[model samples]
Target: MSDATLAIEPSGPKPKPIFSRRNIIVYGSLIVICLYYLVPLYVMVVTSLKGMPEIRLGNIFSPPLEITFQPWVKAWAEACTGLNCDGLSRGFWNSVRILIPSVIVSIIIASVNGYALANWRFKGANIFFTILIFGSFIPYQVMLYPIVIILREIGLYGSLTGLVIVHTIFGMPILTLLFRNYFTSVPEELFKAARIDGAGFWGIYFRIMLPMSLPIFVVAMILQVTGIWNDFLFGVVYTKPDTYPMTVQLNNIVNSVQGVKEYNVNMAATIITGLVPLTVYFISGKLFVRGIAAGAVKG
Candidate 1:
């Protein structure tokens, strides 16, 4: 055989360079996006540290001459929401009250639904999943009115239970999709082996699936915590003023147009409201990345 023919005989076309100009363009765009996203956070930090006098000087980029924790203290203990002088501390607790049970219930329901859809060939499963996937695409605002009426009819309106249920209902479609995709990525043979070993559905799920799903669970937790913590509209509309989440109180403080706007306190309250989700993101960011990567590969 000729050398040229022999050389060309087999393995398909050679691959292109990994670090081509297109790759550089993509990475450069990402860096720009990351900086764009982080700029607000930088502003918030600087603003939070500054006093009202410095803030009015209108140099948003400048550092504070006298950095003080006074704003933070005020935001934590004494910032006003309407006539109420109590700061965001009360709202923070209200958020926790709504967040914990909502996260737990949502995750449990999503996981079970995901497992069932992935493993079982029950009737109408595909139709149900399609509806769920479609449901995720609908804007949540479109459902708010109906949900409000339903909650009122059920006598859960203006209560923590109402807010928790709202979060779970709104969160379910995405969470179910995440877990279902993750479960689909898992090995079918493992499930079959468990079945052959006389394991029942719940037995196999709890024994084999749930443990394997911890990374995805962590991812789910991160998503739900951030969403629930930062929630403002639902908190305002569904909850009583006394039960408002920190975001609502923060908004009221920042947007109150009548009084002398204490920019420092506004910034402080904004940061305080954001701190929980920010902390969760910072602490679990690595785990979040790992979990998402693992889940994506399997999904």
Candidate 2:
């Protein structure tokens, strides 16, 4: 063919546009799903800002004309739980007390276990992991009774230490699984090279694998923090009232059967209690996304 004709020829008649009907439909559906999930959050924010009287009017979607901050103040300081009038602020420190140690201990254990399982092929490693995976499937409720008994026998029940240990135990399986999966996606050659360089197991984990697994580590931290912070059943059953996490206190405030419900306070308390997880997610959201992407790339 002539140079002019060849130059004029289209490149394979051009590919079809990416924004086809199927693509449009899929994206439209996703937008709708996102809106559906966000609606409750929108209602929560609006309702939390409203006074009790506005909430009583029952138009949850409407903006508060009065726009009072009284409910927020009351929910933080004056809401009554039984005869106690102290607000959820009282339990905030308790949640923090439980949250800090639980997250640290659980993450450390999970990272170590995951590294060992992924990099080391010890005897019964697979079996140990298999049991762990199996245990994760068991409902926490089923395990609660036995766990309480065991803690009582060990004289750890009803103590902060006991509750911290409980959170760590429940947190391990999922955390370990997360780390293991992420670690397995890493090339085995890296570990072999480290070993050849005279690095021991802990050295390889600390110096090599752990450094590379920051993304998954962030994800695990987010999961553990949210789970432990929002934990109510464990806190209520395993902890004394004095040591109750905010979720327990929030439940007590909002869940009385015989009294008229304070919907505004209830919403405020729920939001307050949820703020930690929400804040964690908000701040680390970018890190979380990056971590999942990195882990998936390695996989």
Winning model by TM-score: 2
lDDT of 1 by residue, 234-272 (tens): 999899889998889888888888878887788788888
For candidate 1, give the lDDT of residue 69.
82
Ten contiguous residues minimizing lDDT sum, candidate 1: 1-10
Q: Scored by Cα lDDT, where does model 2 land?
A: 0.88
Scored against the true structure, residue 150 in model 1 reaches a CA lDDT of: 96
| Model 1 whole-model lDDT (C-alpha atoms) | 0.88
lDDT of 2 by residue, 53-80 (tens): 7788899999878777777888889987
Off by over 4 Å in 1: 1-35, 295-299
Give the 10-residue window scoring lowest on summed lDDT in candidate 2: 290-299
